[model samples]
Target: MGIFEYAPAPESRAVVDIKPSYDLFIGGEFVPATGGVFKSVNPATEEVLAEIGLASDADVDRAVAAARTAYERVWSRMPGAERGKYLFRIARIIQERARELAVLESIDNGKPIRETRDVDVPLVAAHFFHYAGWADKLEYAGYGPNPRPLGVAAQVIPWNFPLLMLAWKIAPALACGNTVVLKPAETTPLTALLFAEICRQAELPAGVVNIVTGAGETGARLVAHPGVDKVAFTGSTAVGRSIARAVAGTDKKLTLELGGKAANIVFDDAPIDQAVEGIVDSIFFNQGQVCCAGSRLLVQESIQDELLDALRRRMGTLRLGDPLDKNTDVGAINSAEQLARITELTAAGEAEGAERWSPACELPAQGFWFAPTIFTNVSATHRIAREEIFGPVLSVLTFRTPDEAIAKANNTPYGLSAGVWTEKGSRILSMAKRLRAGVVWANTFNKFDPASPFGGYKESGYGREGGLQGLEAYLDV
Candidate 1:
């Protein structure tokens, strides 16, 4: 059967008001940074979206101080129900401004509008609403009688799910009554900056939430500052290590969510069609920028041939183009550096003797992009199988038994997440229990919820980021 063609259905970017230059959001106000400014670009067309303030050492210190002041005076002392009210307002504002946030996200982050609008933006609001309900009910969260707020929290988020990660860190912290100083990734700061406006609209107090923007040095300064009572970060494992070394022996409490090379294990008995769809969404969703993306596909040897055929056919149909286009299934990569990384890793796969395959797809002339790629004949030691490519690249390996599948899937240095596809109930339970990953999805992939706790074991980083346990990250137990 031939694939159907669809005309371009671009989303209107008119909803977004891209400021030519944006300032640092500090202490309930948008203030100029003491450091130099940096330009943010639309990765889809390589257009300069806006210039953003780069937070200096002094700027980080000031933001931290502002959070401390807010924590000690207003935010920490505010009644839990009152705090919930503010979170409720922020959640509502996010809903009202959903289209605006979604358009800006697609423009600034180079992700498909379908993703920013349907998945990322809604989850952003859902997180706030979920945590808002918990704000007034901390005592019932099973964290003992009176869990006190840890005061100022220093949070750093990655670019992949800019606003969603912010909500993940900020929501629970706020629910537990901790004021925060957050640093959004330098490349994708627009949505976070807009979120600052939401705070203002919600009448959230100054210093309650401060957003600083800069590169690694700024993040290092923010996390290492003595004024911050707690630290939460979601990014690469290398940076997580640096933050860990910095926080070691300090009084500050810390939580980190880092890299992953998750395995999507498909058994012979699994529903072939459903598994194929799950596999595609696992890696290609968000252009495979997800940390817990199923980069490694382990298929049962018995059905390996059948599964690959279906998966490739599905890959061929994925649309890749302008992120503003609703029809574009795969969009531009987040940045040039990220594109280079993906390019290099895929090259390594070819060199390492893994059979590389990608459907014939035309890439846009400008901006960073990668065609959805897969590798068969991949050995356990292949770099593509072992490394976290963090792009729409999947490496396939075949396994004979359930035990072998578990062994191959657990071989990675990462233990962030994994998926098991099977019809047998006992096999699913057995495989899930044996998998070393922190999250195991049976018969599904890339599914998330605000109520479910998510994190990783081993090098993928420590502690949880959702549910009641997430609340503990910001509390003094």
Candidate 2:
């Protein structure tokens, strides 16, 4: 399908109706939890899509126990090539149901359908296909000979890219022969529940992959559960640290892909229009909910004014409303809580004396929304410049030279990704080498491929996903 075909619609009362009372997937079957049930809301309209069973501490234990049993009896002992076939089957199924997943994802997560269809669904499939090939070729991976599977993996993903993040977590774990008990973010559990159906369609072994839906407390239960052999998390830095501390005394391996305040540096020698487009995609795509968003723009002093003008023009042209529309560029903020957080952080930026500018745009009533905001004259120490606002907010800071740009870019605790906009190949290589991030895009931003290893340095969290290195996270070296 074409990219433009997935544009989002404006706000309307129309809602995606999800089945009520989704059960936890345990032992390859949909089963009710012993705990209470909770409803997941569509952030765009505040409509409940599904009532999901909230897994209690005991439920998490049961899920982990089931995973451990599956790991020992079936999944771990399965032939590697057979496991690859199962993954391939699941990928194909995902592609078949791509549109449904896209619509459901947009309804549940409040991201534009274009992103859900073009980016999230496709990448989810590609991730599965990519890792499926690795299942039968473990010896070729950089990990040492006779790599063994980690037992039961407890994975918790964020709300931003629910199903895609679930794919990233489960594909590699299954490929490495580890059974998974995944917990999707409470605000967006529909897609993950739908994914459990896909697993069933693939006839995956019972207990091979379980989906537990709940809030932070349930996630803590799953992660801190004694039966979990490893924990893979993608969320905020604070929660990542907590999970790190939770697993400190245990032998459980941990892989965290946390928050980022990436720098998108535009050099004087860069292609201005292209760099502007890259900057827009970096910060504005996914309504700036992306963890590795290029929230900080460090432009060369020579081209700061021109780049800022172009960026503003681009931001002004963005259509904001209706995640399901076929024309929307920006969608609603995920939830009111997140919008409040963005507002608070932006207020801090203004209070800290950074110049804030947002295009004069009308936001729909009755839905959580934030205009695309840009802060100029932002210093390294500015609260907005230093902290991760995590909405469609960008902080523009200037640097006079290459060294200064690199220094300013790496000043933050985040090192997830960086964007260097330059025409000169030598400059791109040099600046990329100096940037302390995992993924560096020379002329682009937020480009993801299943074959590329992706993660971060410093507080952005550890462990790579999507490449051969991703397999290492699930395998015992």
TM-score: which candidate is best? 1
- Candidate 1 has its poorest 10 consecutive residues by lDDT at 1-10
TM-score of 1: 0.99
lDDT of 2 at 420: 92
lDDT of 1 by residue, 34-77 (tens): 89999999999999999999999999988988888898899999
Clashes of 1: 0
Candidate 2 lDDT for residue 308: 87
All predictions: root-mean-square deviation over Cα?
A: 0.7, 3.0
Model 1 lDDT at residue 238? 96
In model 1, what are the clashing residue pairs, if there are any? none
Q: Name the lDDT value of residue 51 in candidate 1.
A: 94
Q: Which run of 10 residues does model 2 get worst, by summed lDDT?
A: 2-11
Please state the error at residue 373 of candidate 1 in Å: 0.3
TM-score of each: 0.99, 0.96
